[model samples]
Target: MPIRLTILIVAGSALAGCSWAPPVQESRTGQIITAPANPSGVQRGPHGETSPVLLTARKMIGVDYAYGGHSPETGFDCSGLVYYAHKVNGIQVPRTAAAQFRFADPVPRDALRPGDLMFFRTSGRKISHVGIYLGPGRFVHAPGTGKHVTVADHRSTYWRARFAGAGRVKTNYPLRTSAVRNPR
Candidate 1:
């Protein structure tokens, strides 16, 4: 019964229509299921798991770490991993943890969703580390020098204590008509 309901939700969620309407789908048993945020496509992460951005991060697992590196071939540092994933998705996240923290709108812990960026103050009182939130208290990150990309518990003692905050980035920046020059 649960499997049937799950299948119904997975199929119905794809056709979420109407802007003013909440993405609420009904199950075979008349249960209500909320639509996922940004149900656009698999470009954000792990399909049937989380956002496609996270799927991209998951694909980077076991990639070697390199200081200031930003590609799979050269390996990646913490922020570099974020940069590579987001940049590939057409999101312009800065190449440093602090800057990346400032790249998106603030998101409270209770509101975190897949594709949100998790920031941490691992060293001191400033943002020093980052990871891609994959929901369910899990995230993907490039840990540090000599380490490989891996998934970590976002709510664990180590990460929870240092948790600075999280944010949701806009893949498409809004265009300002004023920024466009009149050819006239």
Candidate 2:
């Protein structure tokens, strides 16, 4: 039966010391299957989820919005959520929406992956809002004054009209090396 063949293949691979290879899955027909390598090259979690930065943002959902706030206890603004999330994950980013937009590396809308920053010009002529992209045209952010942190659809009329652009944070910063004192 197909089940026996699948078992044999798995056992044979195990006996052949192939345990060091990437994990495999079982198909509907009981066949062993391995996932194809990622083409977009975005770093994902063990379950193929977004990076920790986005995870941090996701945890902030339902948090009350507070202008110029920084943490969950103190509440959060759009940029405050982004800043706190990145900082918690050992990544440093600017504290305001405009500054964060200018600091990030520009990414094309079509190529956006999870964890990319989504900028929006909600008011005036400048980038005034930011969110953490969660893939599939969805993102998480702390929407204005009376709103709490929440996920949003970029395809919606309100957001789509104000959609500014996307950007990625540079995660690689030089590590500080302690200077050795000279004993003269």
Model 2 alpha-carbon drift over 4 Å, by segment: 1-49, 174-184
For candidate 2, write residues 1-184 as lDDT tens digits: 3554345445544543432344599999999998765433234655877678887787677677999988877779999999999998888787888888777778999888789999999987788999998877689899988988888899999999998888888677623222222111
Candidate 2 — worst ten consecutive residues by lDDT sum? 175-184
Assess the local accuracy of residue 113 in candidate 1 as a C-alpha lDDT between 0 and 100: 80
Error of 1 at 136 (Å): 1.1
Please give, for residues 1-184, the per-residue lDDT of candidate 1 as tens digits.
Answer: 3554345344444442232243698999999998666543322334455555676676677677898989777888999999888777666667888877876678899888888899999897888999988766778899998798877898899999999888887656722112111110
